[model samples]
Target chain A: MDMKEFKLNYYEKLYLARHFEDELMKLFADNKVVGWIHSNKGHEVIGVSLALAMKSHDYIVPHHRDRPAYLAKGLSAKSLLAEIMGKTTGCCGGIGGELHIMDVETRIYGPTGVLGSNLPIALGIAYANKLAGNDHVVVCNFGEGGSNRGSFHEVLNMAALWSLPIVFVCENNKFVEFTPMQKHMNIEDVARRASGYDIEGIIADAFNPMETYETFKYAIEKARRGDGPTLVEAKTYRLDGHYEGDPMKYRDEEEKKYWLERDPIIGFKASLLNESIANESELESLEASVHQVLKEAVEFALKSEPLKVSDTFKNVYA
Target chain B: MTKINFRWAITHALDEELARDDKVFLVGQDVGESGGVFGLTRGLYEKYGGWRVKDTPISEEGITGLAVGAGMIGHRPVVEIMYMDFISLAIEQLANQAAKTFYVSGGKIKVPMVVRTLAGGGFKAGIHHSQSLESWFTHIPGLKVVYPSTPYDVKGLLKSSIRDDNPVVFIEHKGLFSLKGEVPDEEYTIPLGKADIKREGSDVTIISYGKSVHQSLEAAEALAEEGICAEVIDLRTLVPLDKETILKSVEKTNRAMVVYEATKESGFGAEVSSIISEELIYDLDAPVRRIAGAFTPIPLGDAEDAHFPTVEEIIKVAKEMCY
Candidate 1:
């Protein structure tokens, strides 16, 4: 694809993710979708950039807040909505709700509800790739809060020791649920934890798609060449509450406004237009296309059948 | 048939399975060049190389998580968690990830892995080194729990557990590791969910597994001399429990008793007693008895001797139910 086409593609993905989260929140309010809805509004660029850099054969272990990662990894919006709504047509047949999203064909492993749990499992996938002599790299995504989990330290040490082909991407939104990063851990930068494991660490501006995409591409290439795992800390923010319906009393208005000004979708759209990659009319058309796709997805999810009683009993064994 | 120790039977089973399929591999601490803590993987590491017989750090959750991930991608990983006591460290991986993978993925993923851990008391290993936690895994659905008594059963059941497309927790008794039994020299396998009749009788039925099975067998012999004619049934697998065999034996004997090495409170014997009462209460002549350990942490040294149910206790239960 040409530069113009590539830039358009990335913008479309970012716009689609932003709109998807907006649509999901609206559905939650209307009672069409139930359960906790985590909107990944500001984390879209990191997920989209990582997806852009990853090969089709490579696998990804996404985070619970990474609906964007799931979409970029080929999970259909309709199925994601269906699963979130607890319908039978969901990707996991409604057994796994919003917290758990995976696509075996796309090699999207998991995002278990338990934080930092997916790290070790992602290492296993990387180990499997190494054992099979495949040059595929596994990308594991989690938040700064997850870095404090024992699983993070344990898995990083093992990954370095085994020289596994994997990348640990920590999206630092500066909050552990409701608490700020200052109260959660002693260190400010999560990338510094990588040095304790003897792995190279890199920090990138997650708001800049080009920087995030370039850093991921370099790390992924290093893993494919058997250079072992790399820890990439993408500094970003959460544009919405920890979960939908969360009262924002814990967060100050100043911090919220600060992050809102740097919203990934808006900044990326401006960049796309400034570079003359696309005109205003073209960008608006792309935005309209994304809105149309998500509208159809919501309708499909609403029309999908509810799970049967036997569906819960199925797949318990094999 | 050839006579072998329970430890060797386990080693031989792992050796054969590793050789049978290239996808089969072992992972755990000291599992590679140093064999295993109990010398279970002895010479296989040198033969299969370090990658196949992987030696890992003292990270229980990490290594088990690796096995789960590898198993999900079509690799058969056999993980040895030195002792059953350490299983608490890795329970998150086994119960949450390994057990639920196949089901939660909508049947798109399969975690074909086996966790081999040494269990039971009498080693004076105390609470940290010794435990009978089979009841924990049996409580979790989508997980197979196998506790074998003799060398023959351990060897056959282990092979089947490795080949089976599900996560299995294979518990080996530390006390019974040195016990000898006859096993076929040729290749063979025992299915998971079958109970073997160690001793046949007609009066009272005793159901046990692991180290308790041997105790029940000895008790049955003593009962036979006293004309009590007690029947001993060894349940090889706990999850896919052979309820039919248990009910049939209970019907014939008209009395039932369950024995295990774990503590009495909420132990596996309680489940067995409930099943017997729920299904065969009319056929039973007496209330089901449970012979088990006291509800206390295993003490140190010889103090742990009386911690487990003894052969005398089994005999007393059988005699009480009969007379």
Candidate 2:
């Protein structure tokens, strides 16, 4: 497809993901939601870019923070909202809550709540898919803090030894809960560590949709062809605190301004508008339509009920 | 049936499964060249080659978690934790992830993985090496824990565990690795949640599993000689435990004595005793007796034999129950 089509798909997905998390924050504030949430609002560009780089049949295993990835994978807004409301209409049928929105059929294996826990699982999926004679690639979306965890090292080494078809997309928003990246690790870019595994290492402008998408295209294609996994460090910012309510005092004032000025949504809008792909009016109308969709999803969740206690033990044996 | 050792029974099960299915494979430390610490996986690497029977670095958390995910996607991964005590490092993956994946999937997924490890207070494996934490695993709801005392149970249960669509913690007692018993020369599969009656009697029920089952049988023989008539029930599977056999024995004999090698504070024996107290309370003539290891860290391996419950202790408890 051409750049115009790519721009349309990526922008719509990025905007929807951003708007989705913003609504979730408000719902959480009103206590209209039952479970905890991790929003990836400003990290949308990276998630959208990575999604386009992957084939429809290729795997995308995301975490709680990658709301954009969830949307990119076409997990329904109604289902996500139902999950937050603990309704049976949710993915995993509300048993897994906000953190674990898995659809094994879609191959979006997880959004595991536990930190740095799903890397090996992703590797296993990639290994299985590769062994079955199909060239399916596995892309895992995690954070910078997860890169420092030993699971990252163990999985990377194991994946390298097996030459598995897995791509690790580290959307490094630069925080592990309350901890800063600088306090713990010496390295600036998480992707740079991939050299030790003898695989391709890259850094991308996570705010630039086209650049991020183009960078991942090569890696995803290579992995799908059984050329081994790539480490794509999408340097971005959360723009919000760890969860819905935390004071980001650790953030530098100028650094915050720098990222906000280069906010992924505004960056893409300006890029498209300057190129005359879509006017400001068109973008405004798109935003309005997305808001309506999200509103309907909120209504669906608000009108839902907590599943019965017997439902907890219903599917234990199957 | 022919004479075989515990380790050979393990190999036979692996051999049968490998020959039957291509998806089944083994992964663990020392499983390839050294053939496992107890030689349980001997000849598997040579027979299947490196890709199938692979040895891995000491990444217990990663290995077990990988097996969990692999099992989810139609691969039967049999991961071995070199020492049962080392399993503490991988508890999150084993207890939480593997056990919860199926239930969390709402039955859309299943983690068909088996974690084989040697546990118990023998072989001088040191404090960090030698320990019995079977109760901790049996306490979990979704997972099944299996402990086989004889070669027959090992071959049957190991084959069954590999084929079962659930996570099975197949624990082998270190003390019984070399113990000889009759194993069927042909293929056999022992179903989970079934108990075996090692000896029959009418006066009392002596209940146990793993190494302690042998001790219970020995005590039953001594009781038989004394004309006390103690029935011995070997609880092969700890979870989904065969309460039917134990309850039936209790209902007939009207008395029960539980035994194990784990600590007395809270061991597998505690669960069996509690079941007797809860389910067969009215049927019993006396409060059930539980014989287990002392509530202490297993001492040095030399003194470890004393730390575990013995036939002397079982016989003494059987005498008390007989009266």
Highest-scoring model, DockQ: 1
Window of ten residues with lowest summed lDDT in model 1 chain A: A65-74
Each model's number of backbone clashes? Answer: 0, 0
lDDT score for residue B284 of model 1: 80
How do the predictions measure up, each by TM-score? 0.99, 0.95
What is candidate 1's CAPRI-style docking category based on DockQ?
medium
Error of 1 at B71 (Å): 1.0
Error in Å for residue B213 of model 1: 0.4
Q: Put down candidate 1 lDDT per residue, B1-323, tens digits, no spaces.
A: 99999999999999999999988999999999988888999999999988899999999998899888888888999999999999998999999988898888778788999999999986887988878999999999999999999999999999999999999999999999899999999999999999999999899999999999999999999888999998899999998999999999999999999999998889999999999999988888999999998899988888887888989988887888888
Instruction: State model 2's lDDT.
Output: 0.83
lDDT of 2 by residue, A180-289 (tens): 78887999999989999998889998888778888888889888787888999988887888877777788777888988888878877888999999888988888888
Task: Report the C-alpha lDDT of model 2 over B1-323, residue by residue, as the tens digit.
Answer: 89998878888899889889887888888898778877888888889877668788888888888788778888888989988898986777778778888777767778888999888877775677788788878878788999989989988999999998888899988889889989877777999999999999899998888888888988888888888898889989988799899889999999998888888877887788888999888988878998988877777758877777889988887787667
Return the lDDT, model 2, position B30.
84
DockQ for all models: 0.78, 0.61
Off by over 4 Å in 1: none
Among these predictions, the greatest lDDT belongs to 1
The 10-residue segment with the lowest total lDDT in model 1 chain B: B122-131
Per-residue lDDT for A213 in model 1?
94
